[model samples]
Target: MTALTLENFLPYRLSIASNAVSDAVASAYRALFGLKIPEWRLVTILAEGGAMSQQALCGRTRMDKVTVSRAAIALSERGLISRASNPGDQRSHLLTLSKAGWELYEEVAPKALELERQVFAGFSDAERQLLREMLDRIETAVERLEAKG
Candidate 1:
């Protein structure tokens, strides 16, 4: 077979790297708080943004409706979050982190940041910035291309 070229190699490399990073981050967070990735993401968004609707949570987390619904229900049941009728929209309820949730977030957020630092431990600040910029550009380009099709 012919050797792989840059065009074929880069996408595979990026995908592998992304998967590895995601797995590592998920494992670290799970060990820290017994939180699955989706749960952790839900908590983080609620903590940062305060109340939101289920649909809004899905949008913020980039998660599917089913996943967001499940997580929200679990969180509510655990007393880590609360849901109430949206006065403006009866069809959609509002969700918010509870006192327990905020307390957990306060405890976890710093550790999560540290974990992120460890994950990128080898990269210099400049390298990290460049990587983020490149990824953003690529994502924007891909989104535009997708929109056209």
Candidate 2:
């Protein structure tokens, strides 16, 4: 067998770690609040931003338009959110958290934080900081490359 290199090993390890964390968080959110990853993302964005258009939400959550639209409709049906016409744009609607949505966010945010903390519990503060910095650098480099093309 050939020797392993950082280029190959790093991506494999990161993918494994990402999948594990994603699975754990998805399971926790589903069990605790019956929310899927996309739904949770929409709720989190609405909670933080108050109100935003679906296009803006897609950008903020890094989710596809269909997923965001479906989640928005589901949340609105559940009485957790409301969609209204965007004053500036006739084609897009703005999404906002309803009272129920805010309540749900309040209920689930702590649990989500706890889940994330437990997931990263093995990492020390310094390690976590370093990991974050490194990840940010990698993201920036990738974005720069994409921008050039």
Q: Which residue runs does candidate 1 get wrong by more than 4 Å?
A: 1-9
Clashes of 1: 0
Backbone clashes per model, in order?
0, 0
lDDT of 1: 0.88
Question: Taking the tens digit of each residue's C-alpha lDDT, what string does model 1 give over 74-121?
Answer: 788889998889998999999989899998899889988897899889
Q: Each model's TM-score? A: 0.86, 0.90
Residue pairs of candidate 1 with colliding backbone atoms: none
lDDT to native, each model: 0.88, 0.90
